[model samples]
Target: VLKGVVYISLSDNMLYKSGSYEMSDQAGETLNKIAKIIKDYSNYDVLIEGNTDNVPITSKNIRNNWDLSALRASSVVQTLQNKYGVDPKRLTAGGRGEYNPIADNSTEAGKIKNRRTQIIITPKLDQFMDLIGKAPEKS
Candidate 1:
C-alpha cells in the first residue's frame, strides 16, 4: 500500500511533439488516467516537473533548455487544469532544464530518457499537524 502518495514519471515523447510544447493526441488518455487518480485523493497536491536533455535548443520559439522545459511543464499544468478540471490551487509546475538528468546524456537512449516529466503527488501537511504535535501556547 502507498504510505502517503504516488509519483508518476511521463516521458516527453508521450506528451508532446519533439521540440514543441503542444500536447499530443495520445497525451489525452494519459492525462485522463492521471485526473482519475487525482480525483480520488483530494488531500494531495500535484507537482509537475519538466526535464530536458543536455542538447542545446536553438529553435526560434525555444531559445534554451530552460524555456523548453518550463513551457512543457506549464503546458501539462494547463491541460490538467482546463481539460481535466483539476483544482488550480493544488497544482504546481517546475522546470529543471537539463540540469537534473536521470540518465547519462552521452547516449541517444539516455538523452531520450532524460527528456521527461515527473508528477509528484504529496499529501497536504494540514492533516499531519496532529502527528507533528503543536507547540505549547505562549504564557
Candidate 2:
C-alpha cells in the first residue's frame, strides 16, 4: 500500500493469453481473491489499469496495443462487477498501452515484465476531501 491506497499487480500471462484480451481459464481463481478484497473494502474505489510491452500487434479484433490493453481492462472490470457483485460505480478502467513500462522493454524478459495489470484500491474522494478540509490552513 502507498499513501493509503492498495496496489495489486498481476502479470499479463496470469490474466490473458499471448496477444489476446480474453481472460485465461485460470484467471477466475485470481480474480476471485481480488474480488474478495474489493468486497472487504467497501469504502474504497477500484482502478484497473492494463499495460503492454513496446511490441506492436495487430489482430482482426485488436488493432493495436492500446486497443488490447483497454479491452483487457474492461474485461476485468466487467467480471468484477458482473460476477463478483462489486459496485459498478466504484470501478474505473484505464489502458496505458506501452507507455508506462515498469521494466526495460529491450529484452524478452523485460518485455514479459512490462506486460501487466495493476489493480489500485483507494479511499473514496469524499473521504479524502473530508480529511483535507480538517487540516490546518496555511497562514
Candidate 3:
C-alpha cells in the first residue's frame, strides 16, 4: 500500500522501448499481473503516471519528453482496458514528463531510471481525508 492507496509500480524497462510508447515483450507478464489484480479488486481505480529524463524531445511527433511520457502512460492504460477488459472508467493516464525527475540527468544511468512510468492504484474513498486527518489542529 502507498499513500493510503494500493499501488504497483511499473518501470520503463519493463514497459516500452526507449523513446517509444510501444510496450515491450518483457512488459507482458507485469501488465498481466496488473490486469489480474484489477480483476481481483474490481473496486480499485488505476492511475498511470509517466515520467521522463531531462533530455528534451525535439521530434515532430514528440514535442518534448513530456509527450513521450504521456504517450507511454496512455498506451499502458489502453492495453489494460482493451486487453484485460478493465473498465475504462476505472483507469486514468497522465504524464509528469521531465518536469518531475526522479534522478539526476547528468548521468545516463540516472536518466534511464528517471525516464519511467508508474501505476498508482487507489480506492474510491476520498484521498484528501487522509491529509486532513493527519493535520495538526490549531485553536
TM-score each candidate: 0.88, 0.92, 0.84
Model 2 bad stretches (over 4 Å): 131-139
Which model is ahead, 2 or 3, in terms of lDDT?
A: 2
Expressed as tens digits, the lDDT of each residue in 1-139 for candidate 1 is 1456688989998999878889998999999999888888888888899999999987897889999999999999999999999998999999999999999999999999999999888878785464346545568
Query: Residue-wise lDDT of candidate 3 within 3-115, one digit each (tens)?
Result: 55676765688888766888998887888888898777677778999988898776678888778988999999999988878899989999998888777889998888887
Error of 2 at 75 (Å): 0.5
lDDT of each: 0.89, 0.92, 0.82
Q: List the residue pairs that clash in candidate 3.
A: none
| Model 2 lDDT at residue 27 | 92
Per-residue lDDT tens digits for candidate 2, residues 1-139, read 8766899999998998778988899999999999999999899999999999999986897888998888899999999999889999999999999999998999899999899999999989998788678878899
The local distance difference test score of model 3 is 0.82
User: So what's the TM-score on candidate 3?
Assistant: 0.84
Best by lDDT: 2
* TM-score (C-alpha, index-matched) for candidate 1: 0.88
Candidate 2's C-alpha lDDT?
0.92
